[model samples]
Target: MATTSCDVAIVGAGLGGCFLAMLLRRRGQNVVVIEQGPSIPSAGADFLKPPGLRVLARHGLADLVGRHGLRRDHIRYYHDGDPIQDCRFPDGGFLIRPYRELVELIYTCCAMEGVEFWFGAEIGDIAVGGGGVEELTLADGRRLRAGVVVGADGTRSL
Candidate 1:
């Protein structure tokens, strides 16, 4: 019944969504992330590759995101039960956390930045025009008007 507005409205609280929200909020944007599920998606890419870690470091989250997660410097490849060449990571290392745990860490950081999360808010209709999304209408009659809309809702997202 109530309409809300944000500088950026992102659908889905996956890795991309949470990371983007944190970035925008840090830059002084009011961000809202809508998720149809109760929390962040349970599964996704498991490794926080070096490039990604660098980006997080710029945001002062390098230690926070990597803390407590496994530091992976090497990985063994296998083919048909036969050991193949082992690949090694360069520089420091990559952070290896389960998909859920990785996302949860960023989600927690987003909360600290005042990013709003609308969990369990199923989306209904999206209005688009001017080569961009105009607004989003949720199933429960809630409308969100965002200056910009981002779809980080994962594969098969609508």
Candidate 2:
């Protein structure tokens, strides 16, 4: 009933999907985020370690994310219910924000970059040839053709 296209088409709206979509949009690529669910995912890793934090910082999102998340410089390690070690961050601290909140924040930024989102859009099939995906067909018969197709579905997926 509908048709759309973009420079990039991403499957799933999880953390990786949303994050990658944001990055691509920032790179001047028209992005389409397709999610089977009605909304972004609500649960996932809650810790943004130093490396991940740096990625945000490099993208100019450090302050925006840090403002709304918890900053902890120390992490206490436990083994068999025993606190065995405490690791301290030498530089910028880590961020502790719910996965949903983190993705939502990035999604907000993506919106400003004009990234398109399709919620409740279940993919039916992908047309592939010449060693790459060429198009996507939704269950409801919608078509999407993109120069690039990303399969960031979930932790465990097809």
Candidate 3:
């Protein structure tokens, strides 16, 4: 088939993938995001946590986060039907959302920002070069060449 090239090639559309795509696109860089799975929705839970909170704040998503995030107060540690410790949050809180939803939102933002997406494309082999990534062979026999390749395919990624 046809071969494509990009400044950056992201393997998965997970949190890091999407955020990186957004950042690069904002800087006027061409990026190709390849996903082996279908895009899902994004829930704003990670935005409410500590590190992610700071990160989202930098991205200007903190306000939206407070509106849609969950506040986790305490956790009860159980030891075989016995309560071991009850952890409490004094000033800090945690938030979480479904993983599928997060992926969906990322994909949506990528689309709006004109990031090229290759869904259902399973990567077979990869070649790295001095400049950057040389080539990627997909399961469908399609070849993708790029100056940079990022492995955001998550756990169990090839």
TM-score of each: 0.92, 0.90, 0.80
lDDT of 2 by residue, 1-158 (tens): 66687999998888789889999988899999999989988878998999998988898988888887898899999999999999898787788999888889988888888889999988888888988988899888999999998889865544
Q: After superposition, how far is residue 89 of candidate 1 from its true place, in Å?
A: 0.8
Candidate 2, residue 21: lDDT: 92
Segments in model 2 whose C-alpha atoms lie over 4 Å from true places: none
* Model 3 misplacement above 4 A: 40-48, 90-92
Q: Largest TM-score belongs to which candidate?
A: 1
Q: Which lDDT tens digits does candidate 1 get at residues 10-109?
A: 9989999999998899899999999999888997888887898999898888888788889988888899999988878899878898889878888998
Q: Estimate candidate 2's RMSD in Å.
A: 1.7
lDDT of each model, Cα atoms only? 0.90, 0.88, 0.74
* Higher-ranked by TM-score: 2 or 3: 2
Candidates sorted on TM-score, descending:
1, 2, 3
Candidate 2 TM-score, C-alpha based: 0.90
RMSD of each: 1.4, 1.7, 3.0
> How many angstroms is residue 50 displaced in model 2 relative to the true structure, after the best TM-score fit?
1.1
